[model samples]
Target: MAHDAAYHWPPELMALLTDTIPLLCRSKDDVVDFLRGAGTSEALLGQFRQQLAVDRGAVSKYRIAREVLRQLNEQGDQGLGVRRALLRRVTEFEDFSTCWPDDQLKARGLVGQIRQVVGVKDSFTRMQQERDREHEARLADRRAAEEERRRRSALYSDLRAQLTALFPMEDPHKRGLELESLLNRFFALDGIGVRESFTLRLEDGEAAEQIDGVVELDGQTYLVEVKWWAKPLDINPVSRHMTRLMTRADVSGLMISASGYSAPAVAECERFLALKVMVLGELRELVLLLEREESLADWLRQKTRNAKLDRRPHTLLGVDF
Candidate 1:
């Protein structure tokens, strides 16, 4: 479409292209064969390709003719012409049969009324490339998410094994202290920070109670009690935990017993219902959750919510899903 370069084309070459517009429908191979048969050499071929871009000197005379020949062989048809001293332009359907019969060019219009193929091939190629890239990006994101989940699961499982190995201690008081240490280490590994046993004051000079453990995890304060007694804990101990929790309306309580509770105590806890006050947990559930590499903080929060909403806790037992 560079009319100025066309202007540089020699008048003889311009006349030749205008006269032989129908001859442009041939394939590149057919055109080459014709040129070779006519004794046109490879040097002439390169020289002809050069003239289409610009007219530097004597070689530029055939530029417009060669440009039309190139486009015809590639696809469809294009013609060179003069209008107001500029080249007239249009790309039209090329008739391949014209090359074989050598007579179809005269039968068809010189720059005929064949409809333009609306560039479907180019658009399809571009859209497919975009879809491939999007698919690859989504696959990469899923792989990264899976790798992070596996890392968290492996770390939690290792810490769980350590905690499980310490369960055989016979002395209740020493076992309770070791259990508390293990709980702290487990909580830290699971990304929750905890505080040691603290003395709770009743807004007076006297200390009201000694908390077994205190932890602010998942936006709630937990007042924890750990018991590893050989005997099943009766209602008295469970009732004591409920009383301490009731003292502070905002605090949630965790009562983890290795030996578990008596039938009457379990019955009392099942009937116990309050708002974010108590969460009944077992040493077994902690072991399972850690062995499965699950989040203890998340389990505690669910239990705490269940106490308020469902009026029941200790639902984490034997859960595999």
Candidate 2:
């Protein structure tokens, strides 16, 4: 699954690259600029420049280019990207007319050689990508299933710990916050979109409404209100949620109660079902579903279905709808 970390250029390819560099540029200054632009170290270029000044005719520009390329090749993969860029740039030059007329054909030939090398590399890269795509396609479904199992298992473990911790939390406010966080994580685990508790402000910056969480399921938005009261949630809080739902057009309501719902509260939600879909949930049922490793998204879909079809605001997980 791993590729080689180093790229070793062949002796022939090195010679081709070195020979092509001088041809790609018209003068020694052009040669200096070309190497400098290709990311050659200033120290190396300085050494080349000093040598050129000392013995202008003794060391040829092609020889200096070869030395620079050789040192880069010794750097292995570290220099591979720069070398490839140089090769690509060499091949991109359209005019050899600036080259000496006698050496023009030779320059064209050297550029052609570099192009062939670059072309082979590109073809190999494309082939590798295509093969990787095909390989991934073969394992996509199984890998996705395994990844989902792992993800849900992790989420379940986290939620179970959070649930256990909630029992010992003495502060009702902190416990309510923890429960809202737990519910958000549970919904998000199965890929349901969730927005944590947020307060909507009025025009004067006063708090207009406090939403425990927001969740989107089956293309419908639901304003979520989570209550962890000791007694069964009565009609007052439920009615407040109903009033909030009334202000928003085409939005539904999801109310989760830790202490369960009183008959009147359930009846209140049922009344609101005529205007908007309202799905009520008990914390115990959610705990049970998590214990059984049930899908929260699927369960919500079923709850929404039952709410729409049977006009029932609440349904137990194990009970037949």
Candidate 3:
């Protein structure tokens, strides 16, 4: 019957029991007002006032509160039935024991006596339990959010340092090679597992072009092309790379151009957008992605999809801060 004791009564009923009853029980009109607020019909309000009058004749406001608490608890089990509507109107006033004069409460000890008989402490305990659960839930959410923030911040610090090392180059050709090697190290640190100088065999018993690098992600391999050229890339090199993409099965390409591409080169790539084999990006973009702590592979996948959707290989998405 412990479960039977719980009642999710209306806010008016709860407010009446907690705030208006003890202090207002002296007046039939005050109780009537509370009954109306709790959705009580006109018929029961008169009878409920009669019961309070009978109870009050013996003691008064404090004496009637004990029976009021019982009917409220019984509401969970539907014990009150039609009369429950009347009890619903029956409410209590806050600070009743303290606010009421001793004469109105019947006696100085009656407030404590009413609490003992009606088990009001049980309701208080349940309220405290609700507060405790809500407080703990809030704390758990804060802890999880903090943990995610710390993990993300730590990963960004390490990767940003690696990307920063690629800048302020003294030689363009050497920088391109360094960038290629840096990608291998970066992917390795990223836990994507890097393969250097990846090559495939052709039917003529000849080795395919010595590709710069390959990254194996989720059981698929991607050929990587890194270029730190001082000048904008043209269509010739981009076309050559597209030719290399046809030599494999279920394989895609990631082309990193530090200086970006020329207009003709971008147009040529857009022509090959249907192939769904390439994701074009710049060194500055990659560095910014690292600074933002976003997933590099996901970013590449999004750019690849964008090319397929809009046929604009050079378009970049804006990142929100």
Candidate 4:
């Protein structure tokens, strides 16, 4: 049956069954035979047979019909299937062969009513299917969101640990290289496109320029430079990056400094901000962002916006501590 096991037939169906079954079957034997063919068990048939024996054909058919329906109702959905099948059989009947000649007209009237019952059953089945589908969709979305949350949490923990370890390293050169790798992974975690350290070779196969890394953000591409010097960066390194940016009109520049920039270096970047899109970031800000589990891309984009609108290349994010 399309309905639940706990489903109770409404009074309309109960009344319909009361009128329809007895009219369709002339005697107790006829009723037993019809139910048997419709898959009712022998035990139930024996119970009904015992009831008919008590009445000995003296009981009203209406009483007999109700008794039969009561037994089927107790059987749950299994009983429901047989009851619905009998109703459908009434609608499909070509003739009133089972009905008495006098009751045939009344029996014919029931086909339309039976169709309404079937219509309600079909509608209820469709509603249940739609509810099940919606529940499954919600579960799928929740699973995906939870999986993404766990993935980002693990990546944040790894990056934070790696950054902490680098501050204690004695060799600045090796520390800078590891910093480049860590930054690339950080950008990748935010779904940004990243290219690791690459060198531009001259025509004679000698290295002309060694770019620390490259990344694409918000539709603009940038050549990245990484520095972890003991002293602050001077104007010369910033000037060289400006020269590189000048060579490619389509490309921008970003410099990440562990020790920050000198006054002249900041001035040089500010001066060049009018000519190209350049953004300077302090490594400490990145550390703070990671400690708070903030977005590196969003922080950099804010710096880029500051450079574009305010012509300030080295802008520090206001950290609470």
Candidate 5:
């Protein structure tokens, strides 16, 4: 009995025929022989017979050929030859020139392209995560370093304040000499020293001139004059003082004032001693040195205790609270 025309094969089975016609059948005669002997269902056979009767241009052939090659590349040639030969028989009259429409082909190609884009996006996301972690680590390191520097600066400032309070100066000469001594102690220099009330007498029947203090630093002797005046002093006297000190070979001179020096005095001192004369701010920087000594904290505590005792009033003997 002939197969009924109303019965059709499943769409998925029909799609299989469309994908396998290309690489197997070489000629129309080969396709006819393949269909007659294949174990296809009666309904599919009838559809194949009818499709073979139509003009080949009305069916898609090149799409079937390309689809077959793509499947072979993807799935390997595992017993696919028989299916290829059956599809060729159903579309024996179809030419490669009359294939599916361009839109249908483009739609099929989009799936693979979308998968490639998703892979690229995933790689970019992973790289960004790594960079973010590295940036955070660097920020953490910078914060730690800044905190350490602040700690060091605070420690230095505290030491300077303590030294400034220790040496209170009433006279300019006494103040400058004491300041020079403090500087020497802070630096811990051996031969480089500071002495107050240094008396000098010239061999040419000269009257004795007492220098406030003499500092020997770096193999050079410096005669320093100190003043604690409320107002600035004239530079001419300092210049003259420096001149006398300079005449004593290998001697330099500096003048320090708590109220600061007059502009003319500063300029004149600079002219005589050049770079040897330096104006140091009274802001003591002794903390840097104190921090290095292990016994400084104990020493400061003792001094504070002594100061407190001295400030207290003497009690009557054997008096009870």
Candidate 6:
């Protein structure tokens, strides 16, 4: 018969009889006896004894009750009945020297170790997520830099094309002169506020000749000569030209060449403290300055076209030839 109510026992008093039971008996009579020993009321004990006698002849009923007690203990119930049953089992096993074998104990330990390794794998997954974020950030930075460089390169190429179209020249020297003039004009239009050129009469007076270009800044005049020599430029001619311009005593001179300069020419140019010399590579930077002044670019295009028409032989004839 199943007990109709629950019960409790103090652990200190219960420990004395813990090893006395064998195989943890769960008979109703055992329950009644435990309650009576704990000083339960006679009325409650009488009711329990009546229930116990109803199944006294049925062994199967007793077995079922024992199995229920075992399940409750394995599931870790805190009820007094389950606790008493668990303590009885512990005592019975201790008295009989019953213990799990080495192999079974080892298998349990390995299962616990596997659980620890799985926890470490979870931490690795988190670290890999952090690394993926960092890698994506670096890739984003590189793409931004590459995009900026591509934009600058395109602007430079466009400006170069425009300059070539505006100042097409069969002679490389004339091309150099045209390039210098356009660059100076662009500089002035961009608010540099400098005089850009001057004409000089030769001593023999065969024809009037113009110096390449000039710029005035802060009360100083800078005479300039431009060269587009595909080969190296000797500085002697440039030095001589600058000397002539400097005869006025008020002018400082500069020389800009598309091709590189000879070493001696560079040294000669350096001799004059007020003179500056720049080569093709340096001149390429002017395109960047022009990009910031779009109006100057437009004016240069117009001036170049007008100059072309004026120099045409048909225009000189006064009729459409």
Q: What are the lDDT figures for the candidates, one per model?
A: 0.63, 0.84, 0.64, 0.83, 0.47, 0.48
Question: In order, how many clashes per candidate?
Answer: 1, 0, 12, 0, 7, 0
- RMSD of candidates 1 onward, in order: 12.3, 9.6, 14.8, 3.4, 21.2, 21.7
State the TM-score for model 2.
Answer: 0.56
Give the per-residue lDDT digits (tens) of candidate 5, residues 1-321.
Answer: 132332222233444443434223443333433454553334334443455578554444444333333333233344255444543444343333332454334423432333344456459768998898999999999999998667655644654665566456456665555565565453333234566556778898575776766665555565656555667767666666766665676665545454555668655644543434432221211232345532322322332233234321111111222
lDDT of 6: 0.48
**Candidate 5 weakest ten by summed lDDT:** 312-321
TM-scores across all candidates? 0.53, 0.56, 0.49, 0.86, 0.32, 0.36
At residue 276, candidate 4 shows an lDDT of 95
Greater TM-score among 4 and 5 belongs to 4
Which is superior by lDDT, 1 or 5? 1
lDDT of 1 by residue, 1-321 (tens): 233443433344344444444364344444444444433445545654454336444432234346544443333122222221122232232544654476465424443422111234347658998999999999999999999888877777767766766767567677678788888777776677688877868877689887888878868888888888878789999889888877786787788987777878877777666344666778888888877677787888788777777777656555534
Instruction: State the displacement of the C-alpha of residue 198, model 1, in Å, after optimal TM-score superposition.
Output: 4.1
C-alpha lDDT of residue 137 in model 3: 96
lDDT per residue as tens, model 4, 1-321: 344455466667778877877777777678777667777678767866776678665666777677767777767766778867766666676678768998888877876677678688779878999998999999999999999888898899999999999989998888989999999999999888999999999999999999999999999999999989888999999899889999986899999998999999999888887789898988999988888788888987888999999998888885532
Determine which window of 10 residues in candidate 3 has minimal summed lDDT. 86-95
* Candidate 4 pairs with clashing backbones: none
Q: Which has the higher TM-score value, candidate number 3 or candidate number 6? A: 3
User: Candidate 6's residue-wise lDDT over 1-321, tens digit each?
Assistant: 232233232232232223222122344466445434443345544644655568555533334334333433343334455455534433323222222243344333433443344446458768998899999999999999999667655655555676766445677666665687676755564445555566756788654766766665445465666666666778676667656665666655545555556767655544543342221122433444455434433433332233234321011111122
Q: Which is superior by TM-score, 2 or 6?
A: 2
lDDT-sorted candidate list, best first: 2, 4, 3, 1, 6, 5
* Residue 35 displacement (Å), model 1: 21
Off by over 4 Å in 6: 1-161, 166-169, 194-198, 202-205, 274-281, 291-321
- Which has the better TM-score: candidate 2, or candidate 5? 2
